[model samples]
Target: MDGHPLRLALDLLKGTLALTVHKIRYGLASRLWHGTNLVTEQMSRHTQQVRLLRAGEVLGSLDVSTVRDEIGSRRGTVSFNGCLHQLFSGQPLTRQEKALVLAQLVASFSLTTSYDFADSPLLDGDDRLLMREVLYGAGFAAREMRTFIYQSRQDGQDTTADIESKSTREQTRSATRKLEVVDVSLDEFIRFHDANLAQKHNYRRWDIDAAFVADALALGKARILAARGRSADGLTPQGIQAAMIYTWDDISLKLYRISYDTAKTANPHANKVLIARGMQMAHDLGLLLDTDCAPPGAAILYERFGFPERVRTHYVRATLLSKFAAFIRRDFPSLDRRLRPWVIRAVTRVNRSAA
Candidate 1:
């Protein structure tokens, strides 16, 4: 199973080292998490190196054949291990609760993706297989269940790794956002991401479990948005957790979840803009990233496609009006209060793509 499709699908984590996803940078995770930012940058990167360790498909760009030689090959600002955690940690574990624990803990359970190497004390023999079965079910839908990955700044290091080989040109980076928990149907996830994905960059496949979604939905651990109908949706935000987000390559970059700090602003749009601005601050600090398992532009690309400037808007009642009021009141809160407009939870033809 060394070069098996599943093993090759994605790069595994290195050892038991902990991972930190910038909440502001991701989707599902962002909603559930409230405070505490493990990552210091606003951007991250991925690669086409690894493959689906489960299916033996060329899920990633970094293949086993070149493992040893590129173990620490510097990409933009990320590493193979870092990128693996970024993508892996975003997946839902049980879907039982809005924020499941097993899924997030699983991120650190095994650094490597193994086949026939089953010894996860977390799940016994039967339970282990059952877990895989659920993951497999989610894969069958073939819907985009947030396939991207990310890394937080290391203890003292600005952790946005990048893809830059000694002999090749370096990949570009983007503003990073704090990582957070978010959830959505594979279709909406895909559509929201692909619609705005740039032609120049893209992420590799993950041979993700087809049964994962059905299992999650059946377990009632999390909620999956319907492909055809929904006036609105919700999710959690904060701390270490597994979450999903639509990849930028998907065409429906709308309807993705976001974490809003009510204290940040009364006007919703500006609040979102502030989040984007914060991510840009992280990126400006030289925190963009890239790694071996994914293509050269993975990390920063994730943040870029999810940037506020490029957000996919959807109508949120008075958000249309409150957004304007927020803008007018950005400087003079007291004055704006008298003129402040109310925000009602409603829907209309607003841009669906926003962080």
Candidate 2:
């Protein structure tokens, strides 16, 4: 019976319902009842019993004041990955040393950003639980932590740490590539976006606020990336031939913006190079790669690159409904209006959020 399709469907439904209920309960307990302290305390005890370093010890290595200074002085000039590269100097670190550095970086950033380091998505589920306690017990907020972690992730520091071996290999090949994609400074990124991608995207602003972009880039340094292709003569650099913007959305590296200058550049691989770089970054970070939107033609390219496509049935349905909503509302007034309203709301939210 367990192998039967109907049985499987029932099991799936049951699991979804149970998860929904658990989330609701957790939300209420954590927010309304302030039950975070209990969980925090339990995690704290677990860490202590396991003989893990105390919160103070972990945080001592990367002091808060030092982080503050770095944030102030190096906001847009350096990336977390760049900093790690300088610190480790391409040397391999043991698992323990890596973890310690990750924890310290998270703690330092959390302190400066006024966010809970423990709740950072950079941590795996178990690590997040453990660090939640550590950070909370160390006087970081258990509740009301905000969006600083997202920015920290864009810096690509911790993720870079995880992929040091891969980066080292890529570094060795750097001398051979004549036209390569590279990290651009924020000003360069903004100018390229304004000139190239913004036009391609119809001057549509990415959902990211300009101020947020500034702040995130200042913090993460990996948020904006660009590439230069060959000039018309195919021998020299053609400035800003391709560009892209991406950020860590949970465990996925979501590519939100991309453009290539196919007309001016002699290099046909401009787009591919930019995309491949993003794929490599995703692989290094141990994250899946996704994009916000891809046109119908781009779908074929994504498929060729091994990205499985799910036809967004909701989009199809909403589009159909949008065309027929007034007609339906006028012709069938007595029919249930609830679904129309729900669909409209969902569609509105999606459109507003789209780049």
Candidate 3:
């Protein structure tokens, strides 16, 4: 009885109606409070376009024709531009259609790009395999493989005692004597982020502009944690030793973007405490904890904190020769078989040099 199609349809209908009502209520509230600004306008348009695209995708009607038509009609609009990549992300695409989308993505964002699809968590193995095949067929090669590790809410709970070891508790108390972790305002987060920009990897930069942070906060998607050293007077703190910026996943409520200050610090355990605090926050929120796109040696630290690796995905780039080889393979199949080995060797050399 619970598995009836009518029951499922009713649930879907209710969800759709609830979402529509929520959007209307939020729009009215925003108009009352923010009073309409350029940012608000852009956000509104973006939201509407995304909603349309999502609706199309969910109905299984978002074909290449629809994508091209929308792109043509909404060309240069903030809405379309904001979600152009997303338009194809959730749709089941043919190889040729995927190639076209990949071409557009390369043109808009360069040969190297990494972003979660619109329905990442919902994608099964077949979907992921298709996406991988599409990328491979589009001449992309792996750059770095990042694994996402998650701890279930139930598993994450009851770990307080495990985390607060006698040694760690003593150390934490001692560390807190000289240092404190505090919640930072958006403005403070921005300032700290900007100040530490030079510390981040040049290739793997996370865009942290004020508007983005503000929007994230408004949508309840982000949190900022800062560690400040205590003053001699035991009242005021000194400077920031570390800060962590974590964002929430809407569907899974999983935590992401678990970044911390990389600047040299006197206390080696500062980052550990910050990570522990992040886990606690996740537990408090009754959500899984997830960290994505970690740098080298980061997995070791995360493992130390009880987060085992779950999914490994790679950041890939398409080289000119690889694209040329792919083009040859597609256009001249006979030539491709004869030159495949040479092309592989050439690509390998180029990748090594680039690395």
Q: Which candidate achieves the best TM-score against the true structure? A: 3
Candidates by lDDT, descending order? 3, 2, 1
Regions more than 4 Å wrong, model 2: 1-178, 197-201, 230-237, 264-266, 310-355
- Please identify which of the two predictions, 2 or 3, would achieve the higher lDDT against the true structure: 3
Residue 216 lDDT in candidate 1: 28
**Candidate that scores best on lDDT:** 3
Backbone-clash count (model 2): 1
- Residue-level lDDT tens digits of model 1 in 1-355: 1343334233222111222231112223532362212222211122222221212222112111111001111112112111212222333434342122223322222122221111112123443444343333222111111233222333444322322231111111221222322345655544443443444343422112212223323433224321111113324322211213211111111112322222322222222232232233334443321111123343344444332111111101111133243344554677666543332212111212221
Native-structure RMSD, model 2: 15.8
Give the whole-model CA lDDT for all candidates, comma-separated. Answer: 0.26, 0.41, 0.46
Please write out the lDDT profile of model 3 over residues 177-254, one tens digit for every residue.
667888888667656656666665432222323334445566566777877777778886677776776655433333
Which regions in candidate 3 have their CA more than 4 angstroms from the true location?
1-124, 134-144, 152-159, 162-178, 193-211, 231-234, 252-265, 314-355
TM-score of each: 0.19, 0.38, 0.50
The best-first sequence of candidates by TM-score reads 3, 2, 1
How well does candidate 2 score on lDDT at residue 8?
A: 43
- Per-residue lDDT of model 2, residues 1-355, tens digit only: 1244456445434533433443444333433342111112111110110111233232112211111111121111112111111222123655444444333333223111222111222334544455444333333333322111111233443332222245432432341164666677656766766665444545443322343345445445237777774356876755777778776532456565676666643455566556666766776676656544467666555545545543211100011232244344555666637555665566556645752
lDDT of residue 147 for candidate 1: 30
